[model samples]
Target: MTKLWQQRLQRQQRLMLRYLRLVFNEFFMIAVFILLGGAAYSYAGYIKTLTAPLWWSRPLVLILLLVLLTVGHFATLLQAADSLFLLPQESALKGYLKQAFSHSVPLPWVLLSFVCGFLVPFLEIGGGRSLISIGVLWLSVLILKLGQLWGQVVQLYLPTTQFRSQQVTFYGLSLLSLGLGLYSWPALGFVFSILTASISRWRLQQVQQQHLFQWQLALNQEASRMLQIYRFFNLFTDVPQLQGQIKRRRYLQPLLRWTTGRTTNPFLYLNWRGFLRGTEYSGLYLRLLVIGAIVLLFLQQVWLALVIALVFSYLIGFQLLPFYRSYWDYPQQRLYPQPASRRQQAFLKFLTPLFVGIWLVFSLAAYQLWLAPFGWVIILGVGVFNVAFLKLYVPNWLKRHEN
Candidate 1:
């Protein structure tokens, strides 16, 4: 059983390494370092300017810790076939699960510790918490995280219908532990966390004694984790293994119809419909737009907002280029009487309004930041440049790649 678990762990590591390499290219790594540096600098500046912490500081810190404790789910690396093939080794599987728990919990602990440490300066400066109290808070969070992990394992024994209710109960307990610790009751909070952990372990033992391994549930959970990783990686590179999900989104259908109706070109209509129905392209566009909007709204720096807006515009155009290329996949599309240039025109037409909408969002944010006509002019100028760049460059680039 130990040997089998080691083999599975190694396989998972190799798969993760393969994807991580694709994601952490040279340019991306450099950008990440720069972004981190900028964020740390900005955070320091913000912290220094703080005058005795805001009234909501303690509750916000407590809530963030609660969220961190409760939000993480476990990854056991167990496969669907394990239940069937290893049913005879059910007793030995406990040892494997023990190994899995040890392997899984440490990374989250480290990350959670880093976050707690990051908030320390803020809490000390703003929330008026002492070093001892903050230290106690950190330890309390660590204990609650352990309990949460064990609780997740206990959940595997539960029916799907009861899983969410169990999570809510566990989260409530975690919040209670946090609340007690924040209120200068560290001893009680620590005891409560230990109790939660003990109960979770006891429940797992009870389930193991009465039930067989839940292979399907473990497999589903593992698949969901892998899919999330793949989806994030897909944003940077083409992930052929990535499966697309679709939703009917019936309410949005009218908007699609109206947009497509404005264009008589068959390719334009197809482009609009494909974007509205296809998951990857449409989802990427919206995610980037939302991220850009969030950056503009919060960053308070005109140059930074413009940089983010332009970068997102480029990404949106680049990702959507495949929407046009997807048409060539079908023989019927090739047989259409529309000219080749019409496809380029259709792409530009579809992209223009989308970019314009993004421009408006950024411009509004710029207005908030600068409150000047010059800021508006600068935003409009950048928006025009992005649209012109997309219109002139993307179609040619796609054609070149196609040829």
Candidate 2:
């Protein structure tokens, strides 16, 4: 029974479900979905911004959005090399490569389907709309997936340029038709998806008749090398030491002056280096600049701005942990003499600039309301907590473990 259960657990269907859950964990991806969906809902209200007037804007955003979706879809699949290469045999490679996440052809079609489906609902949600429109949107996705698999199978069997071109042509048409459906005839387009699926199936049958099934091993080293290159690029952007010098980062200049000609803590030095040298950390200040602008834009109300300001300060205070180990080589003799406490004043120092930015944003936001006075007092208290009092207080700081 246990062995049987284990087999079931390892089944492809179960794994696909697991992959779906993992994909949802991506905050940016989820945000993309919600933003697109929400944007569609709010688009009618935002029609004035369109350059081509009202009638043209609806189709324009649909087309642009479809393009974005298709591009994003292909990009996402390319990044999923791990999921694509799970099979061990070289002969079975063709089949595995042609599944739900395949990129070469299917992604564009899928993107189109999703964009069209989303647009259709918003563009034609009422007034005697055929139920087929909603149903056909889903049908189109199934067909696209089928078409992708068929194309891959054909590529494997025929192994010719002509077959590949056919796949590309089909994929392009799927996307174009989806866009058209979104603009005018969603119901007919949905049904058309089913027809597309049948054509894709027929194409697959033709390929199967002509070619033999064979598997190829996924190229592991190629994937690894590609990842390494990406990691190197990430170091330039994600790591702090590689950032270009910035004039606006003059606030950090004092650290260099204070440390010159004097012995300093290497850890402290590394932290400062990361703060100064890293684009991401420096980005915090830039974000602070933007947040103030956004708060005023979104919630012209005074209290909202004050709250956002207070929260922003706290967030900056808390997010400094990642910068603790950015630059420097450790010497054998170097060791921590004092225990690091979570409640240590070190945290407050890192948070001060963020808090200050928040205060400025708050002051600007609530310049007129009586709430400005209350917010000012709170800001003062937060400053004392972050600077004066926290400097003297020691809390539960986590010391590094000796491996």
User: What C-alpha lDDT do the candidate models reach, one value each?
Assistant: 0.74, 0.47
lDDT of 2 by residue, 1-403 (tens): 2332235335634644554454344232443344344455446544434333245545565456434533422111222343345324434433434442343355456665666565553444332234565456455555555555455445545656777678677767677656645556766666666666677678767766666543231233234533443433332223222334434467667865554325343344444555666666656556645654454444433444444444444444434444543332345224544334322234344444545655566555545543544545444644554553234321232233211
Lowest summed lDDT across 10 adjacent residues in model 1 is found at 26-35
Which residue segments of model 2 deviate by more than 4 Å?
A: 1-53, 68-88, 94-121, 125-168, 195-266, 276-316, 325-329, 332-348, 354-403
Clashes of 1: 1
Clash-forming residue pairs, model 1: 53-126
- lDDT tens digits, residues 63-138, model 1? 8887787555687887777878887887787888888888888888998988988998998888887888788878
Q: What's the alpha carbon RMSD for model 1?
A: 3.4
All candidates' TM-scores? Answer: 0.85, 0.50
**What value of lDDT does candidate 1 attain over all alpha carbons?**
0.74
Most accurate candidate by TM-score = 1
